[model samples]
Target: MSEPPRRNDDALTLLAVLTDDASRAQVATITGELGDRLLLATTIEEALAHAAREPIDLALVDVGIDGGAGLALVHHIPALRHDARVVAVAHRADLAHGADALAVGADALHLLPLAGDTVASTLAAARSRRLDARERHALAAALAAAHTTRRLYDRAMSALAAGEVSSAAGLFLEGLVAGGLAEGLALYTALGGAAVRVAAIGSLSAAPEEAAALEALARPGGIDGAYAPLRRDGSLVGALLVSGARATSTSILDLATLIATEYAAQRRARAAMTNIDDVGPALTTEEAFLAANEHEIARARRHCRRLTALVLRGCGESSALAVRRELRSSDLVARLGPDELVLLLPETDTLGAATCRRRLERRLRGLARDEGRGPLLVTSGAATFPHAGDSLAALLRAARARATAGAPYVALDRAVHALPLGELVPTLARGTLAHFPSVAPLDVPFPGLLALAEQLCVEAQRAGLATYLATDHPGRNLRAPARSLSARDARDAAPTPEAGQRDVRPDRRAASAQGSSVELRGVAHLAGCADLLVIVLRGEHASWAASGRLANDRFVGVHTHDPRLADLLAERLEEGHRRRNPESSP
Candidate 1:
């Protein structure tokens, strides 16, 4: 009843219960040839004890043992070891007991004197069956594990899509661990151009150089084991780093991409919500300011009079009161935000608006000095109608762009000398066009300039924007594309030909263009402007300008979305027009 040596899992163990010497020898020979461990049980009790304790793969029972009590042993042996294959052996005359063994739980019945080849084949077959069962069990376990992994991945994705970034990252890290990846995982989000660790799992610490390398991997390039970049709108916004073996696995890479995408989406959603919260309030309330501004703009447009808007930031209640005292009864003063105020000055041109702004600044400064507060800090920006914008929103945008505390306003003349027009135009256009609504002047040949101008003019006209084009060769510029103008004129036929036409008198042309409120002046000659091309566009929502003086066979100037710049340039061009024609209505 002593235990035998431990057997290999692949090798089989056989328990033989027999009374006959011949049957015992035959079983021994078969077990030896099969390379299986064989155990002998002289009594039925001994056989049952072996069955209970041993890892038996095949059990050979002598049906004639214990006065045929071995049949009961056959039934109980299988119950003890469910995986053990039981085969009953009996004499040819004891065929009745063998059949009874079959009726019970014995898998097969064999007769003695058992043939060597027949018993050998039976033992081999039983071993093969045992191997197959083991494989199936392993496969089943693997399938269950795979199912669990899939469930974890699905849950992580669901959480990520729901904006639960922290929960998602944790679940994803858990999934990696469950998949046998015992590694440190760290997720870093890009904040203000630097990698910030937002979510992480395990103890992942790196030196400065190692951290730098991880950040580098987050950029647009190859993904090393150190980190994987999370990109949004083709720009890397975050990185995921891993430490240890299996860090660069396919599952890890795929999860990194998914997590990056979801995290970026989450950030964008938050930013959008923040933007919604930060919207500038209209004087008192946004609605009130908008309503008042709209009414003033419509009245100004109807009467062909100028309207100016001033956005003042950092204007306290005292400064605002001082500002109101200086303003005329017709002028509007509204609280734009907690410390911001907007002024709507009716019938005021840019010069007049500037005069009013200076007066307010002086008054506010005097009040501040009297109150013992030094140098009243207020930023003011001005936008005038037909100059800054045609609509309230456009005017506000223009004024806000020019407003900055402690920053001196760069005049149009000074800005022109600051940088080369070719270099400066493109520099202004750098970044998203949606945020900075400026046209980036293309560096094209001299002939391409005319074509580019024509294209821009056509687009502006199609959008129903008030366009003003001032070129020395006004006739040649728009007349070259006569078909384009002809079609537009057919749709919007006015009695005064077109505003830029050379044959029409300047006064009549200016008056006629007032119907559309568009001023397209074709100055015959002007100092410096002989080679300069200026295109001004003003719309309800947005206004922008593109001006370039011909230099080195290309137009070099400024392209700006700032409505104030557009207004400034438009006024400059109008001044040239007035100088040339002494009778044109100003």
Candidate 2:
């Protein structure tokens, strides 16, 4: 009915060819309901021009135009627009002319001034044909592409089976060639602490940090034309970065998955063997964790004991050891990878897990201090049983998504109510490691957010804390000079972009020395390293879960309405810092 309301951004274009004044008037009466969607062309030349520039869906041609040369136009419509449907019309009903129109590839031949019912039925049939033709063409193209991909994929699989391919990189290159790509291809492999280039065909190169960021985006699923993560057993090991004009095909993604799976199986086989001799009774393997988690989940279901799963990423082996030492003997611990760990906390509720997290944060911070490194930046997320998930894999996925979303802790508690905006700031200080300021439905203005950030930065500096005020706003109209904010001296504070400056660093890591508060823009790479990261969720870019994954400490959320909110936030942060390091109090 009425063209199904035009289907959001997919309005159809109809070209009406009426050479005479009388014909124009009659055509207008039939298509007046379509309004601007109908394009009127007086001549065949004008009709062809419209077809060339716009995607014409349907065309109404009167063969009586240009001394009946319109019959010739009917033959050329297929060349002009293969997808467009044509309805040939005449001033009066002439069976001979209608027969000729039908012979010349016209979908329908109608006589003008006919009954409204006849016109509607004839046009409906033409539109149906147009749609059916489009679907057929699309299906044919997709089938052809799939056939080509399958052929290439089969060859790659054959090579692997025949021992012709040796490395993961080589397999990846084969995938690219299968996808009809020979240039501008790069492959990055996640090697524990960082991402390394595994293979390259063209001059394209992505930095280690860029590769890491790309891998993060690919975890849930690969984005088109960007990168695809190589996952095995539901964990990310590396990613394939696609650049330039070559879009990633489904076959390419499947090939990457196969390669990753092969690699992981080999590694796990070796690890499983070594664990029998090397692993102590205190810690377990991923296989053990799976069995134990399922068993505990069943026990919890029967006895009603609470269970929680915590996943930690980017933490080194030392951190993992420290975590094992701190955990109770009853707790189940397992290694996810070289830099990842999973802990199953039995007989623990969300609140208990949270308290444990805070204590561990303090201990880890102290450990980092002793090691003379920035606080061990660990991105962790926890999910509870029954509420978060019923199975181990589901729970792990939920936690990983929350962790990736930058949420400090995500509870699958379907019953809990979100805190109000007014109390969110305070609750953030007490419970969460990172806070996203609550805003109303009416979005806050950009200037208000900048003002709030400035206030927070000033307070941070006054408290003897190095502050970084990073903004991803496109303009260079910051409060300070628009240049890199690298520290010049140990005690030097993080710099700010000067007003009226033209430089804009879309992704910059601005850090202060001891008690550093690094500011970051769109830099997902620096998020894990920041002692405190302040994110201003403005407009549609607001994604709080992603922000939590970046900050090492709990982030603070502020509102534009409260001018005094920043001062209170800074005071609470300082108080918390002092409480953590009471022995260092001056």
Model 2 TM-score?
Answer: 0.34
- Can you tell me which runs of candidate 1 are displaced by over 4 Å? 1-6, 179-252, 264-586
* TM-score winner: 1
Flag regions of model 2 displaced more than 4 Å: 1-10, 19-23, 29-32, 41-55, 114-123, 162-195, 199-586
lDDT by residue for model 2 (315-407), tens = 676777787777764466677666667777765554345435545655676787799885356667678776788877877887777667643
Determine which window of 10 residues in candidate 1 has minimal summed lDDT: 500-509
How many backbone overlaps does candidate 1 show?
2
Separate clash counts for every candidate:
2, 14
Error of 2 at 187 (Å): 5.9
Native-vs-model 2 lDDT? 0.52
Per-residue CA lDDT of model 1 for 363-417, tens digit only, reads 7767877999866567688888977789888998899887862234333323442
